[model samples]
Target: MKKLLAMLLVICSTASAEIQPEPIGRIQTLPDPYPPHWIVAVDVAFFHMNDGKLIVLDADSDDPAGRFKGMMNGTFIPVMYMAETRPEIYVLESFRARGHRGERTDVMTIYDKTTLAPIDEVVIPAKRVSAMPTEYYLQLVDDEKLALIYNFTPATTVSVVDLEKREFLGEVPIPGCSLIYPLAGRAFASLCGDGKLLTIQLDRNGKLVSSERTEAFFDADNDPLMEKPAIIDGIAYFPTFLGNVFPVDLSGSAPVIGESWSLVEGVEGGWRPGGIVLAQGDASGRLYVLMHPDGHDGTHKDPGSEVWVFDPQTKQRVDRIELALPAITMGLTNDDDPLLVTTNINLEVDVYNANSGEHLRTIGNFGQETVFLFHSDR
Candidate 1:
């Protein structure tokens, strides 16, 4: 009887040891030939307020690899990828505290690019502009040494954070100006409400070195310039609501406003440059703009039916790419086979060959309204 009980115990132990439990999820190593281009799409949810997400897509394979979805206070949170020293991403967004309508806390969260794991977060004290997408609201300066965050708590200001040290330095007050365009050296330029360009020079510690404002440059009320400017070689080309291109030279100590040029000379009537990302400049010094026909007084926010490529140096139209669908926003990749991506009215990203202007493919359903398409290489 003792020998039988011992044999049964041994058999049970051996069987239990052989039947090892498998891991819940296995980590598989990826093969070679990874996707080349990466596309970052921001899904701005108006109905489900807390369901906004920053989705990352592989352009070559057209697959969504990773995404970050959370409660955000506003509609215009921005994400920036830092690919210099390490693979990391920075997102400037706000979160609700106790309740949905409770106190808001603004933060800059850093995430690992590979694993999509959060690394660190720095709290920002100032309230950011939440209504519209401000292009330069959060801009990196001095080769990622400092991070400039634009704030608008009924007053315009910029909060400078030392990215290298991972600390918030302080806020620089630009009373009447908004937006930030990093100039040469440790300075930045802002567009003022009074139709002037405000240039502010900041030291390493986020202190103001010097500040100056240019004379009233353009008419702000009737023909206000678009927020996103195509900056090339220290020159910012701003497109107005009336299809006028305004160039400002920021290479020197101050901003030098150049003569304004028209973008619609030979085109028929009721045509104007309009869209979220209306204008973008390429590496070859060519400018791409979205144009729409039958534009009215407040039609600057309308979707564009065509894309017009122009040589800003010669101020002449080079190529016109007609779109199958009206685009509200557009972006371009910096690869050899550059792709011109446009977000249509149905929130689908229509890809096209930038050189030949041939339609490639449409990538996205995203499960929400995608407002912007930012290329990693661009």
Candidate 2:
């Protein structure tokens, strides 16, 4: 097996331009005949202007090229959708919209990754997707199940599908604002959005095991202003734009909010939290949080990109690194060492040292793709 060595150090700079691509690690490049030890391959969703497609690239080497590529040329994909499966890409399109034949439709397409072939398609009920957002809305409960979050219709249900068999598992009614996430040994579905936070637990057998609700709303107190909670080791850490980190431990008899700490001191304007990445770093069983860009200006601009590292145990911010561009979807190598991979809005994919925010190498160009999304290294 070939190995890559990349060292990352906490580089503090007054400006974000100091970081550049430099060789610090070795990436094993695999050819047409994939080697067993190739380890991980990266997938990038390319939305080229009106034409959208998915591109799968191998990150084993600097010049390692894309293994699979497909195009949706004239096809229309919904906005604000997340693809959450492996070897397959799911795209939810518009409702009552004309397809190639001008037929009324609301459809989600599942494409095979290896062959770039259409495996199956799911048609959503017309009324369910007519809500305010008007986007093909859904969330992945896991690799298999998907919680369909639609609008207006109370009869709307979570459409669960068996990814392996490529069939519908079942549908369950989960009304209100709910965010579905894969956690621990099951799926964590939190119905929040409409003031109250109602959490439901789903077992591996596709059954509802238990349900709970928070008696209040997320406000200035208790660091309730965070976007969402990310769970690590059965513990959910909530980070807010107000610069507070709320740690909630759910491993006990009753879930309780454990510790709260201020991450950024007097953060001007507010701190907009981005993606949260957690991995076991040392022998002490400690986990770190990867925070995205934050600035004094109250803007959700694309260029506001920064990576902040924090000790989840202490709930304190330890290191901060600024990036050239902001990140959308990110992943980490599944090994003892840490290698951070991120796809940015600038249509570029970068490999960085997870511990020390150092840019090692970059792949691809962004001007070709209007939008870009990514999945974990598989």
Model 2 residue pairs with clashes:
5-25, 8-356, 27-60, 347-366
> lDDT values of the candidates?
0.75, 0.48
Model 2 ranges with Cα > 4 A deviation: 1-50, 64-97, 100-113, 124-157, 169-171, 183-187, 201-211, 220-224, 248-257, 266-297, 300-302, 326-330, 343-345, 366-368
What TM-score, over all chains together, does every model reach?
Answer: 0.86, 0.62
Candidate that scores best on lDDT: 1
lDDT for model 1: 0.75
Error of 2 at 271 (Å): 5.0
The predictions' CA RMSDs to the true structure, in order, are 6.3, 14.0
> lDDT of model 1 at residue 210?
91
Quote model 1's TM-score.
0.86
lDDT of residue 295 for candidate 1: 86
Q: Compared with the true structure, what per-residue lDDT tens digits does model 1 show for residues 22-62?
A: 88976432212213455556655545545566665555554
